[model samples]
Target: MQAPELVERMLRGDRRAVARTISLVENAAPQLREIMAGLAPHTGRARIVGLTGSPGVGKSTSTNALVKALRARDESVAVLAVDPSSPFSGGALLGDRVRMQEHATDGGVFIRSMASRGHLGGLSWATPHALRVLDAAGFGVILVETVGVGQAEVDIARHADTTVVLCAPGMGDSVQAAKAGVLEIADIFVVNKADREGARVTARELRQMVGQVEHGPGEWKPPIVSTVAAKGEGIDELLGRLDEHHAHLTATGEADRRRFARAREEIEAIVMSTLRARLGDVHGHAALDKLADAVATGHGDPYSAADTLLAALDT
Candidate 1:
């Protein structure tokens, strides 16, 4: 398909266009560069909110409820649910959207499931590219949910205007926020399933963790909100806190600084990837193949051979 037609369809809010654009970005197809370049100006209008937490915290349920609420207010919403597939198999179990009841044909809301494609932090590297597409496509709100919790999913902080960390009671509640590096980035902390017992204790633990962190520039403290996502309880308060954090970011220019930094990092990675692609063409893969065989056989040191090959690539 021609690029212009595809872009036009995207502007029309065509679902196929959304999928196609994301695929183009994910594959890093050089041909889509021109299309994305034109689409860049349409981005930045959407407010991105990232929701994340450990397993079984009703994050998906909460996300669906929130999207439904916004849609009720006549807002256009887009949900990018990023899930990681098992490395052994090459498919995703991105089933979070299934719990989102009654919004399939709502027209005001768009929900698309995404696999991480093995990117670090359980987010595909092309995710920012997809975000740009959605931003340009004019979705008023975009929510990014990531909960792959071993290493502090800090990438969400880089992408979202406000980061929300969700927690629940009846578990190792005290360390929930602290252990995931979430205590640092969360602008708003939510103790979901708040109707359950131990809700107050969980909230207290999160508050203590937040208190220990050195107040960042502008020194606005993080607020903890309790919610029962299943029944839509406290969602308004959650949304209000989200807005407050966004206002703080805007008032202090922290938002712009973070966006600029994220753009720089993404652009640098793209440039290096392009350079590496150019390297293979210049070095000739067949010759490099023989060099690889030689190195494996102990006939040549991998470093010197790689240096020689890379030097040729510069030319």
Candidate 2:
């Protein structure tokens, strides 16, 4: 199908169209620019929630429980699970679609597993564009589940309106979360597997850590919610906290600010990628090779070589 027609179907909430469009974005298909352009007008409506944590932190389980809770409240939800890529095939290794099988038959729920494809920061590079597709598809909420690669996963904060960082007991996850710099980015923290031993201690440590942050009287404080996601315990409370955070953002006009920042970052990323591609094309013409040889032979400094490459782009 043509990009325009595909975008039309996507805006009408056609799941197949959404999937196909996302695939095009992932593969960098030739029609991607047209598809994104067509979808732009319909974007920016969905609430984006990013979930990140260390490995074995029950992110997938918590995500599944959260989906059920949201569905019960009559909300249409879309989940974008960013899984690690297979070194051989560059496809999702830990497919969240398999983990979230219960939601497969639900018309109101859309789940997609995207390979991170060696992108750092726990998310696929295509995430921002895929989000545009989901937002345009009329979903009330969009959940982004990262690959959970510890500290670097903090990138989710820039993409999500609300960031939920998960940690479980007995894995030193609390300390790791602190070291990972997730403490600063989390809007809501979940101690999943709350029924396990030491869960309260984990919660207490998080509370203490959160208490140390100085905030204005009206500033939103990150809430640490305990959950046994496997059993669906505390899912309601987690959802409640998310709702409270969203309300705070809306009432304070922070939502608009966040969305605006997200757009700015997205635009900047696209521009950088375009420039890098153009640089590669210039390199193919041997302009870069000569510069590299000059630098290697100590005939020119690296800085001057870089300038020459940039200057070549102008010609």
Using all chains and alpha carbons, the TM-scores for the candidates as numbered come to 0.87, 0.91
Most accurate candidate by TM-score: 2
- Using lDDT as the measure, the top candidate is 2
lDDT of 1 by residue, 1-315 (tens): 778887888888887787788777756766577777778777777888988888778788788878877877788998877654343432333373454346767777777766555443223446687788888888999998775654435777778888888888876744855875777777888899999999899998888888888887777898999999999999988878877888888999987887787788778767776666687778768878988899999999999888988888767
- Candidate 2 achieves a global lDDT of 0.84
lDDT of candidate 2 over 156-270, digit per residue (tens): 7888999999989898879767877887899999999999999999999999999998978999999999999999999999999999999999999999999998888778777
Q: Give the TM-score of candidate 1.
A: 0.87
> Global lDDT for candidate 1?
0.77
